[model samples]
Target: MTDRSHITLYSGGHKGAESEFGQLAEQWGIQEVNFSFDGHTSIQRTRGMKVLDPEELDKGNVSMEIVSARMGRKFAHANKIRKVIQSIFHMVNNGYHVLAVGWIQPDDTVKGGTGWGVELAKLFNRPVHVYDQERNGWFTWKDNAWTAEVPELDRDTFVGTGTRNLTAEGKQAIHDFFTRAFGPA
Candidate 1:
């Protein structure tokens, strides 16, 4: 028998996708690692989450406010984003096939970061399955099946198999690809 390959699933704190992914992980016995910076703690603090300090999350945010802070803020944000992307890339490079599951919304800030996950998957030659918010009819196909509309990060990458929900076919594809790369479920 071959080894069961490990899959490193990249995720964020988006409640909806997080919950869905957490459920799937529970069902499948898959492990997940989430990457995040200070803002998460600050948001939680302001909202009175008692798990950790309220001030920790504000470090990056406060550094963004230093005098003549425009450039600092931009670089700080860019650096954080770069770190997050790098973390994802490192996980893939370390030989675990990745499953990047998270939110992709219409807002520009959120959308830009969503693309990073796609780019990371492409960089590692892995498949990225993006789950979007809107339940639109556009993703529906004549196959009488619906899927999430997944877009490519660049031209050289595998344009994802868009399925609104993770259909049995989609799951089979994932299972097959990973099994080929690693081994059986």
Candidate 2:
């Protein structure tokens, strides 16, 4: 098995998928960095947590109009979501590979805030993977289409973000992913 000591997982450390990723990263001896902002209370992983200040958060800011257009949906609480979106930018920006656990909508976008990170990964041309909970399979973005594949953590740094309402399958997928990449944690 490849040494995973140097691998770092960048995430938002929310309750479900992100928290599972963080926990698995710890179990596998991989470094983890969880990005957060003020007034954000849902973070589950505190290890290596980096609370982004307003200025740093602003660095990742984009117009809500652009985000809505890109996401193919509108945010009712644009002001509240802007900070989360900005923090996601930091997670995606710092990580080279993006792995998400969510539903891939018909529009070819992963669902929820995780979708924003996936979109950014696509726009940045970084390798992106999604373990669709609904589909119960892994898909990788290739040539503008999501192709089925068993993905591994090929990069030293990667972003792990996904839905807050993670299912048992999603949790197992993250565990299996780490096992496949690192073996016997």
Q: How well does each candidate superpose onto the true structure, as a TM-score? A: 0.39, 0.97
Over 81-173, each residue of candidate 1 has an lDDT whose tens digit, in order, gives 544344333334432333433333443111333444444444455544444334321221113232454322222212222222444443444
Off by over 4 Å in 2: 1-3
Pairs in clash, predicted candidate 2:
none
lDDT of 2 by residue, 1-185 (tens): 45777889999999999999999998888999999998999899999999999999999999999999999999999999999999999999999989999999999998999999999999999999999999999999998999999787667999999999899999999999888877897
Q: Alpha-carbon error at 167 in model 2, in Å?
A: 1.0
The global Cα lDDT (0 to 1) of model 1 is 0.35
TM-score between model 2 and native: 0.97
Q: lDDT values of the candidates?
A: 0.35, 0.94
Tell me the deviation in Å of residue 176 in model 2. Answer: 0.7
All-Cα superposition RMSD per candidate: 11.1, 1.2
